[model samples]
Target chain A: MVEIRMRVNGVSESLDVPPWVSLLDVLREHLGLTGTKRGCDQGACGACTVLVDGERINACLALAVQYTGRDITTIEGVAGGGDPHPLQTAFIRDDGFQCGYCTSGQICSAIGMLAEHGAGSASAVTEHVAATGIALSGAEIRERMSGNLCRCGAYNGIVRAIQDVAESPR
Target chain B: MRPFAYVSAPDVATAVRAIGTEPGAKFIGGGTNLVDLMREGVERPGTVIDITALPLTGVEELPGGGVRIGALVRNAHLAAHRLIRNRYPLLSQAILTGASAQLRNMATAGGNLLQRTRCPYFYDGAAACNKREPGSGCDAMDGFNRNHGVLGVSDSCIATHPSDMCVALAALDAIVEVESVRGVRRVPMAEFHRLPGDTPHLETTLAADELVTAVELPALPVAATSRYRKVRDRASYAFALVSVAAALEVDDGTVTAVRLALGGVAAKPWRAYEAERILLGAPATEESFRRAAAAELAPATGRPQNAFKIELARRTLVETLRQLLTEGSAA
Candidate 1:
């Protein structure tokens, strides 16, 4: 057994778990935060995506013990108390998901993707590597968000939702 | 996944010591591919030595104009690094084109080089895969051989090395620096990944006690003008069906020198040495490109499902060289 200490969704939590338990399990079973869904736990499907220190990664492939001192933000932490985050509202408005098995991961990944773009990161489609704060074209967003898959074929709506937040203040 | 002893090493020495002493111990960085293998019951280690805590995360300039990339450097950071993107554009393009943004953010350079093939037969536990279990026989030899390697195929296995980063490294004359309990030794990228001969299980030449500390790319002006073009079923987040990494130098309307490598067609990054020989000092023309590409792909033995790869590889190489020549003309 390994006792790991980390801030999960803005809450300080210390939990003892098996060394084999993934970060996805720590979020879903250990902390009882079931918002992060697990689909294809081998990291093929991005259904278990979460933010560790503001960067998106597949939680299912990450060991909870390896993330002892980092801050993990799940779908629960996108907005703290009163209102949903801008991207969350944008997803609802644009109908980003159809069946919604991949909604949570999609939202969390979008949050990190926008943050990465704000930090002057380039995507696969970015022709100019040195250019900072790249123009968030649809093709660029699509390529960056390619990890999150929607079996219901909701890519058009998902792109619209991300674009809506890209132009917003939040 | 089987629970094992875990040690998070604080320094490089500690990590190397633990890794060298522990039999069946594996280094965990990013855990993108290794963890997947564990889940598939392909790899069961006695211990996992965590090397992420060690101070091996940076892209720094060498004494020469080349660059030294730390082993723990994430794929995203390496792609975004100014030195890599500016000096080795093909490397940057290759890294960005291989995996998704999230995976790239977590996957390390060392782990990226050691990633296994995406062959379905290898992943299937019930299937007969010589790479997984020696003498089991290859299911992909005649079963669902679409994604199998056409070049460098042995009777034992037909898997392709699924890495875009290494393909670019091969073309740019990069060297892999590895350290063990003994000492550090440098292996060229061309010789780092081994072809799937009789022993397909032995993917890389990395020793059990050794750890890849850094990948060094020598100074090459031609690599600055290099380009990588990948053809696949999807435009993003998929392994290459046929990828080309090309670095060219043209002088007085003639090709002075060239470095070319192909991926998704072989067990290792297939360096087009004969092709480059033909293009060097030749006029930059479609005829010359075709001749060179044909020389490189002549030895390819296609399967029933993947026979299209030969012509596709041919066209892709010609198209890339055409664009390179056009860009040079415009410049």
Candidate 2:
């Protein structure tokens, strides 16, 4: 077993796990941080998405041992004591989720996506590859969020929520 | 996943030695593909050698005019590299069209080139897939062949290599540098991936003990007018229905040179040499583009559902060539 110590949701935690133990399993089983839902054990569904060093990644695809010293932020760690982030607030205001199982992933992915675009990362739908921070079109948003599936198909509201937060002031 | 010993190799030499000396050991990079495979019980490696921390992540200008891309360079870095964007436009476009943003950020050049097929039959263990289990009698040949290969496919297997970077690299004539316990060797991009002839299991020429060190791309001056066009079912993360990576040089209304490669149609990155031969020195017209595409697609033998891929591949090529010509003329 490999021993890993990392910060999760601003809290430092350490644990010993086998090589096969996934970050999703470690979060749900070992640490009892069950807010991060697991939709698919494979990497297809983004229910287990979490922020690893400020970037979102599918927790199911990342091994627990691989994130020894990195910083992890789960759905539970997004806001302290009920004050939600702007994206989370926009989701609540826009009724972005019906079941709420995929909300955590959606919020985390949006936060990362905003940061990616803010840093001038281009998406597939970006017409000018060299352009910095191309306007986030609806098509771009859907394409970027394809990894995260919503069973309820609440996509229109989710896109609006993300767009609202992205367009809002800092 | 089965129990395995975990060892983090400090460098490429250590990684190669670890794989060479240890039996039933496998190297792990970003673990985007290998970890998922392990979880699904597809690969059962006794030892997991971590090579993510090796000093192999850089995109530097070669001694000559070309670019030397490290094997550990992530797809995100490649897409953002200024030199690659300016010189190898097709490579950047190809990398952007593949997978998702998150996956691309984690996937490396070596892993992208080495990713296995996403064939449904192979993923489903109950189904007979020769690529996954040799002599299993490929169930995909008759059942659900929508995503299977149509060009350069054999009776043994019909799966296509699932990589966008490889399609562009094949067109650019890139070279893969590998380091093994014996020594270092280079494999041309054209010969790197093997067709699933009788041995559908053996995907690439890479030996188990070899670690991919770097990938060198020969500089192409005409690459300034290159493009990568992929036609997929959706606008997002779906795999390509038909993809084209094209670099063309037009001078005085005539095609000076052409490098055309295709994906989602063959077991390997189907380099369209016939198309390139027909296109070189030909007039920059849609008729010539169509003719070249036809010459390339003549050898394509499709199954029941994938017959559309032949026409799709042809039209994709024509559309890409037309766009390039139009872009050149405007410039």
* Local distance difference test values of all predictions, in order: 0.89, 0.87
Model 1: lDDT equals 0.89
Model 1 chain B: ten consecutive residues of lowest lDDT: B322-331
The collision pairs in model 1 are none
DockQ, all candidates in order: 0.58, 0.48
By DockQ thresholds, what CAPRI class is model 1?
Answer: medium
Q: List candidate 2 segments past 4 Å from native.
A: A80-82, B328-331
Off by over 4 Å in 1: B328-331
| Model 2 lDDT tens row, B1-331 | 8788999888888899889888989988888989888877888898999998899999999877899999889897788787887788888888989987777777899888899998888888889989888998898888898887888899999998888889999999999999998999999999999999889899999998989989999978877778888898877788888899998898999999899999998889999999999989999899999999999999889899888999999999999999988764111
Instruction: Calculate model 2's interface RMSD in Å.
Output: 3.0
Q: Candidate 2, overall lDDT?
A: 0.87
Give the DockQ (C-alpha) for candidate 2: 0.48
